[model samples]
Target: MVKLIGDLIKDVIEPGFCLGCNACVAACPMQCIKKEENEIPVLKTGCINCGICYGQCPQVVDPKTLQKAIFGDNPTDELLGTYTQALAVEAKDAIMKAHGQDGGAVTALLSSLLDDGYIDGAVVVGTGEAPWQPVARVATTTGELIECAGSKYTRTPLFIGLRDAVNLYYRKRVAIVGTPCNIVASWRMQFSEPTNRHLGETIRLRVGLFCGGVFRYKEFLKDIIERQLRAPLAEVAKFDMKDGRFVIYLRHKPKRELALSAVKRYIDLPCKICSDFTAEFADISVGSAGSPHGRSTVLIRTPTGAEAFDVAKKFRKFSAVELEKVKPGIEGVRLEAKAKKGAAAKELEIMRRQKKPLPVWLQERPPEPPKETIESLKSISRV
Candidate 1:
């Protein structure tokens, strides 16, 4: 339906609705698009109006249609999307647990999928050329998974590697792990009208990471880490956001902390309007929220996700318990998801009051944002 570049810009881009998922950049048949600031894509030339970008954009695709296409029903929940089960899990292997952000469930699960023939490869985010930056990669081996293990609190145009996974590597079945927007785009690419049926066929599993908002890594790294701390990038061993502060760990030096309120200024614009926190459409969604420091909360959304978990268990890849056993537990996740929904609803209201027409995705509110959500744009402006 979106036949022209102008339509996409007006409907999604201009409204600050583009999620920077790179679906448009990747789907461009002419390769006329490239990412700017390693975030949103910019057209390299004049309009092509090929419609491929629109066909793949999650912003304009209706979730009801996507739900019916994926699950054959419109069953919905006010929070946490459509899911069958929720649990807390951690990798069984010591090595996996050591390298991953939390329990290393993603790395462990994807490794099992790769070994057990469930998927030939996985689209993952790894360290970019610069410190604290994220780069999309396709990992087919355990070593590759380890390389991408830790969290990068930033957005990576992960699906951009989908083409290489299919056309170049010829992987018939592949898994993909991404934020909510990335998962949405993957599903829409499969079922949307005039879809890339081939790519959809190759997507064996969709894994979503729980996200609140992703900060601009370049700004956080350059402005805060380099300018404020004057720390050498190589000496910085890890960066994390926990307990309302951005924690920077160095190889031997003392750690540094920055309040989340201050860091909120660098959050991507599209993240403010997001409507899915737990990646409701993903086969399995995993996040550290509502779990122990060394564990991940896993939301099994579909039969496929359950099947993958079973296979991972069979391989002795992870150990999981009922979510009820955890301290924060399912209630913690629910409250966080609800808070994000509320914030997004407020954002939409402000947009409407300002006479700004919203795109289809943002016009509706009330679902999805990861943990530690920003409360008010007004508060952020003061920052």
Candidate 2:
């Protein structure tokens, strides 16, 4: 029997392995799946059992299979994943730089793409009705992209914006910025059978953010920030993870910080099992780990990504420091990735010993492809 959302819930969601990337909700033809704040998706009335939701779910899909399909037989890096080059970059736009989490490279890159007419819209996270809460939306202009700047340490279903971009707005070419899990779900939607490939095809670029983990909104914002720290959410200027602490910048008060260990309990459960810290499947990955306080570390992972970066650079959207010029350089990024992967591996091992359910990708290895097939797959361009 073909698996359905119920099967997906039993295998992934119940196991606390669901990434909550919203691929299933976006790809559902009947629009039966709905995602609520800090919850796994719930199915409504439709019961076609088309299996599209199951196929597009990042946890249900085998990541290795998707990697082989996307990156082909390229020699894999133990830490940082497949990439062409690394750089330290900072956005030139003063407003964007000021409002952004670090260097504002992501905001600048998306603006550059929009200015160049490369993409009709971009799926990005913006502040929602509640303070510090993230809501996904489609940005069609540079101003809109800038408004959506900064990092939300909480997870949002980005694919919902993707669906609105393609289906509601009828945007032909689009870009998406998301975490590693979100990138994985994008690949699953692109290559998985019984999925809406058109939704994947509309995505011209995938800009991934380096993620340590995400926090539950209620616990992190309400319990930790409001009650514990005695800071009102509305007064918060920004949220950041710096030097092993969760830092909160408030508009009218001195910034407050708590050691990450203090808030570890609030981290989403699924993040513990995730190993991709640099978004290995993304076109490009950007983060603050390897660069100076005001700069971002960027990894150009694909030819398409390289092309987009080049366009942005040519337009003077951001200033770049060559990997060698940056102190610690890619090594810094590699160390962070290694630490995250190590922690995940240990968690997986612990879960295994406890006889808990695990995602198929973590439990089973897919057979290697033939040499000829690998070569052919590599020749197929994602662009």
Candidate 3:
């Protein structure tokens, strides 16, 4: 059966595979989609079945097929995806590093991109009305970038920022930094023929953050933060999941933490279904997952990503160390990635027995692409 945008609501959304990334909402030309307080997208009224929303959705197409479309037939590592280089990096700017969740490489890279005119602005998630509440914003200057530097453990519908950055703000070239699911959405939107060409043009760069999982803010904040941690939301100076604990740094109190496994019960269903640990589809992926306290593991996955790194290096934004020389080396990342994939595969099987459709990412890997599709991919290659 041919799939349409409406099909996404039943096949993926209702089944709990939707990442709430807002890619579908941005793709809808009718402006019929809206996300409520619960963080799920709902179609308002007009039902054209135009398919752009589904085409732009990451959950609809197989990740393996998308990878082939982007990376050609050259085999990629099972864990790291296709990459030109891997390194441990840290921002040279001390202030950025201080504000950063880890190494500040993402903010430093965006700073260089803006200064070099590679991008007009960047889409970032920052503290919102409530502490740790993620608000998507366009960072047009270094100060704005710095304000959006750190991580928010909660899932933010980050791709919605693209709509504002392009339609409302009228930015010509934009960079976006987001988690693994967001990267999947961006890469699909960038290449999907049904997506608005102008909207696709504004996306100049994709920076992905490695993610373990995202906690539901209402649950994690009210229950865990206020009730268990005995701290108010406004007092949180910094919050992150490190090692095996959920660490919270308050402005006036001693550091507090809880077992990471204890908090897993608060993770949303979509995150539980997600398998991309290192953002396998992103041009460049950065995370503290397998790095020392002061460094970030940077995976340069495409030629464009490598070029961006070279430019950032020329500007002396950050320094890179050999991946093998780092504390939690490439092997650490590989093991985690494999474990996540295995867990997802097992969950997919259980869902299958329950008469639910498996998400695109969990489908069997695709074989070689047809000659025509390979040619099509080459023509569409932006990097």
Encode model 3's per-residue lDDT on 1-383: one tens digit a residue. 33576678877788777767788887788988887764678989986878788767877666667676778655378787888788998999999999988899999999988899888989998877777788789999989999998888886888778888998889998888988878778866766656656666677778888887888778788777888868998888888876668888999989888887787778777777677889887879998877888898999987778877887777788888988888778888888787778777777678889977676545545244356754654554454
Comparing 1 with 2 on lDDT, the higher-scoring candidate is: 2
lDDT of each model, Cα atoms only?
Answer: 0.77, 0.83, 0.80
lDDT of 1: 0.77
The Cα RMSD of model 2 versus the native structure comes to 2.3
lDDT of 2: 0.83
Q: Candidate 1 or 2, higher TM-score?
A: 2
Off by over 4 Å in 3: 353-357, 360-381
Per-residue CA lDDT of model 1 for 117-163, tens digit only, reads: 98999999887777767888889999999999987777778777787
Cα lDDT for residue 15, model 3? 76
Number of the predicted model whose lDDT against the real structure is largest: 2
Candidate 3: minimum summed lDDT over ten consecutive residues — where? Answer: 360-369
Compare candidates 2 and 3 on lDDT and give the better one.
2
Candidate order (lDDT): 2, 3, 1
Q: Cα lDDT of model 3 overall?
A: 0.80
- How well does each candidate superpose onto the true structure, as a TM-score? 0.88, 0.94, 0.92
Summarize candidate 2's per-residue lDDT along 70-163 as a digit string, tens digits. Answer: 6655536879888888899999989989978899999988898888988889999997898878888999988898888999988787899999
Best by TM-score: 2
Worst 10 residues of 2 by lDDT: 374-383
